[model samples]
Target chain A: MATLAAVIASTHHPFYYKASTAPPEERPPFADEWVAKITAFRETLTRARADVLVMVGSDHFHQLWLDNMPQFLVGKAPFYDANWYNEEREFGLPRMLLRGHEELSSHILRGGLDEGFDLAFSNELRIDHSITCPIITLRPEADLPIVPIYTNIFAPPLPRPARFVELGHAIRRLIDTWPSDLRVAVIGTGHLSLELGGPRQFGPHGPDPEFDRKAVEWIASGDIERALAEVTLDSLWTPGNATHGFMDFMLMMGVAGEGAKADYADSLDLFHTMEAYFTWYPNGVPA
Target chain B: MSKYLLNKFLFTVDRDPDLVERYRSAPHETVAWWESTIANEILNCHGGEASTWLTFDDVEREALAGHDYVKLFELGAHPFLTLTLFIAMFERDYEEPLAFQKEYAARLSHFSLPYPDIAT
Candidate 1:
């Protein structure tokens, strides 16, 4: 029974690979700062000795398609490598640590339903950047095995806010039922606000400060359910195609529970269009 | 054709105070702004019954005549507002609309909207 550590979303842009390899000085301040933050965050995870991670992010069209998109899909591979960033860069994952984690997938599928999430399990699926970026960012050493979960937040007819919260509880239940004696961490990626594409794309890289302030206040106070409920497409995301990805942020709150607090948060510039943050669930709380 | 179209349109307007204010203060001008700024591609792809809910008044029709679908959908109050309109449009008969909705989603995912977290 592996323990669940983090439920994070992939906050990297789809063009991150092309962007990241550019010389640091030539990159935008936001991108450069993010790489540093990601590197530091990974070091913290290593220090915490987190043994297993349950990463939650949405896929673009890598594995599931519109014709057969499941609301929830869990990766069941014993050893899966990320296709876009890692493979293209010749970066190697810690394959030895990844060897024996199949049961975690079964446990999540079984437990998720008990908490009311209709999760689909896939063994042969390959992981894309959404799942891979956070892993590589937090654990460049790949010392721990990860259970990747993909949500259909980006497509039309996305799951409602309340349903996403339910999925979080389902993940908690899945972690509690795992047979392993390991500790876990969950990471949720995506924006506090601001959609990445279309006209909303024109200016405003940082999110609406008042909204971000309210969200932080809500999380610090431990009223997670309310925080989740307060988020809507218009208020929390950009108006166009940009709104789809923010659903992953709501799902992260579900996994983090009421007690988790934001360890770090910052809004960046490029139009002040981007935001990045992290939340951690301390060990004392029961899953 | 159904009264639901008007209900859905008004319901959308009522829910978004900003748009309601704009419509009340300057209806024709607001309509023009919507025509120019919205993404018609999204409207054509996901609009479904929303196209009918629109009143197509002479001025609005003239403004929107050559507009793209995505732009038309963007003119609505919010993404969710537009989304719900589509949902309501299909909610009655349900089945066929759902299949269309699914196909529409697949197409959207192809353009990089589906995966926000992956490093490109």
Candidate 2:
């Protein structure tokens, strides 16, 4: 029987790539530190050698727009590859990953909506940085097969956070029903903060490190529901814009389950504009 | 004469205090920006009163800028409004057009105004 090996979520800040390849002097202030941390996280994923990766991330208006936005969309591609470029123009994800996306996509949509959530479906779509960046950083070779899941939390009328927790369970149910012998991993990508456009353009990045630390500590302690309840909408939106990615944590916790132990967890403040946290679920089943 | 009539007409319609504040602060400048942008040439234009004759270009620009076209039209006291305009024009007559809109309004009401009067 197929089992979920891990659930991972990270902040998807485009500048990470910009900082990675830039020369030391030319790089953004904390570029070197961020690159090192990202590299280490990637190493963990590669070492795990998890077979199938289920990627959950938000779509910028890049492919789908408000005119035809779907709350939850699953990619039905046989293979998926993203051609992403960095500031130094270095390319990533040289090859595509073979995937069991069709089954995963169908099952997730059916299960999610049956559970009272509206999910969008798509086969003809390009993978965006939200899904691409973390995948490439972790699996530079793109050797593992990927199943992409898109959440519309970035857009309005988003699924309630509690509902997102339910979506996580729906994904678990979908994966359990699959007939293949696949060892699956789940990933959620977005931000831990919300510094947008111009405000983020200036440097020497100062983020609300204290708040970020508190949020991560809650996740590590496995008190997600309490942590979520304690976090107010204003706290997430103001100060440093960390509220946008709270749902990512909720979705991840749902997949990780109450009993699953976290193998790794850390939050890194990057480029003032972006803050990221990552975690891995070692036990496949929900605890 | 046209400016005075337009101003009077605007004052007559029921306007949300929040929207009224945004309009007083930036409506004219925003309209000017839309007029010069490509969308104004495509969406708001119609063969009507010279002052009321907005092209599709105008409508497109307003939509792109994240403004409510229907509300803008009602607030601006235009001669004719688009179907999108009906959304705000008949707020009492209809529920919100999209689920996202309702959630956004609820979540970000500080930034949003009450729905515009629809009877106009």
Candidate 3:
């Protein structure tokens, strides 16, 4: 059986790529601190030495559209082309291609279906920054085979926050039960009190600093009950229009398990959004 | 209220470098041409199998043609779509980083929370 090496969750701040890699003259003043934090966060994954990764992220109307949008979809292909043109245009994210773990993808699809997930599968998926940002941040070599799971955080009539958590729990079960010796890490990224394309956008701090602060506590402490009690589809709008992305973190909390404290947790306060990182070692942290 | 069509205009045009340029420089013409020639075409499908009933309403057409992002947001055309495409077109006009984004926020600052429902 596969080992669940690590369970990780983070905020996928699209600006990090540009902010960290820009020429010294062009770089933002916060870039150094941001890079230092990410480097430390990256070490958590490196220490786990995961062989396969299950990446959870939401599509920003990239491949998935309002027309025929799937609430939850899994990528089960041999190869996945990553990032998109607008990502390059808007965030300076590089185009990427990633290998897929088909056998595990098949297992998850079958197991998820049997578990009543009604999982959507795509043979050819061109992933966007939601999935790629973590790869860039945690595993920049982008060398490991991955199974990409995309949730619909953009469109409305979306799966409620609980559904995302349920799927995460299911994914953890499926990965653990897969008939392979591969060491697997499940990494998911979301936003914290983000207000994109809204009146509060591009502010000095995330639109709702209070919400971001409380959210960090819930995730770091694995307080799923409080998170679920406080978060709802409508309530999410209060923090910021784009705060629905926080549900992805709630999903990661499910993978980490209720009351399962993250072994490694860190955050950086930045403009428009807060950058957060958490990693859990279910089998104890590697020495 | 074809909010879907409104978003489709942003979605399709933003992805194509040529269309982003065309829409940026020639808003009225691009909207008109899109309405007539491309609006009905179903994305990710055979061209002959176009969607015939997806035309934008009068308000949607003008809001897009006039580049009224504020109106588009009011009409629930998906703010992310509106913002991404707008940045692609207009970000270059600003001298400082995020000047356009901050301007965008200020422009819509009058609106309070319990925002317009974005459900399509």
Q: In terms of DockQ, which candidate is strongest?
A: 3
Query: Compared with the true structure, what per-residue lDDT tens digits does model 2 show for residues A47-131?
Result: 5557888888876544554435677787877766553222112223333444445666666667677877777777766676777
TM-score of each: 0.61, 0.65, 0.99
Candidates' lDDT values, in order? Answer: 0.53, 0.55, 0.93
Better by lDDT, candidate 3 or 1: 3
Query: Which stretch of 10 consecutive residues in model 2 chain B shows the poorest summed lDDT?
Result: B77-86
Clashes (backbone N, CA, C under 3 Å), per candidate, total: 43, 26, 0
Q: Candidate 2 regions off by >4 Å?
A: A23-25, A81-100, A198-207, A232-235, A239-242, A259-261, A284-287, B1-120
Q: Considering TM-score, where higher is better, how would the candidates rank from best to worst?
A: 3, 2, 1
The docking category that best describes candidate 3 is high
lDDT at position B1, candidate 2: 14
Candidate 1 local lDDT, B1-120, one digit each (tens): 222222234333434547655655565675566544441223224544333223444532432333222333333323333333333333344464235344334433434332232211
Candidate 2's DockQ: 0.03
Give the Cα-based TM-score of candidate 1 against the true structure: 0.61
Separate DockQ for every predicted complex:
0.03, 0.03, 0.91
Per-residue lDDT of candidate 2, residues B1-120 (tens digit)? 122223222322212344334443565554454344422122223543234343334443343234453334334322121211222333334453233323322333333212222221
Candidate 1, residues A1-287, lDDT tens digits: the string is: 55554444335443344445668665654667666666665554655567777777777544564436688888888877565322242222222224325777677777776666677888766676666666556665666777778887765556776677778767876776677788877665664444432333333444355665565465444467676667764444433345556567667666667656655444333443444555453443233
Displacement of the residue A54 alpha carbon in candidate 3, Å:
0.3
**Candidate 1 - CAPRI tier?**
incorrect
Global Cα lDDT for candidate 3: 0.93
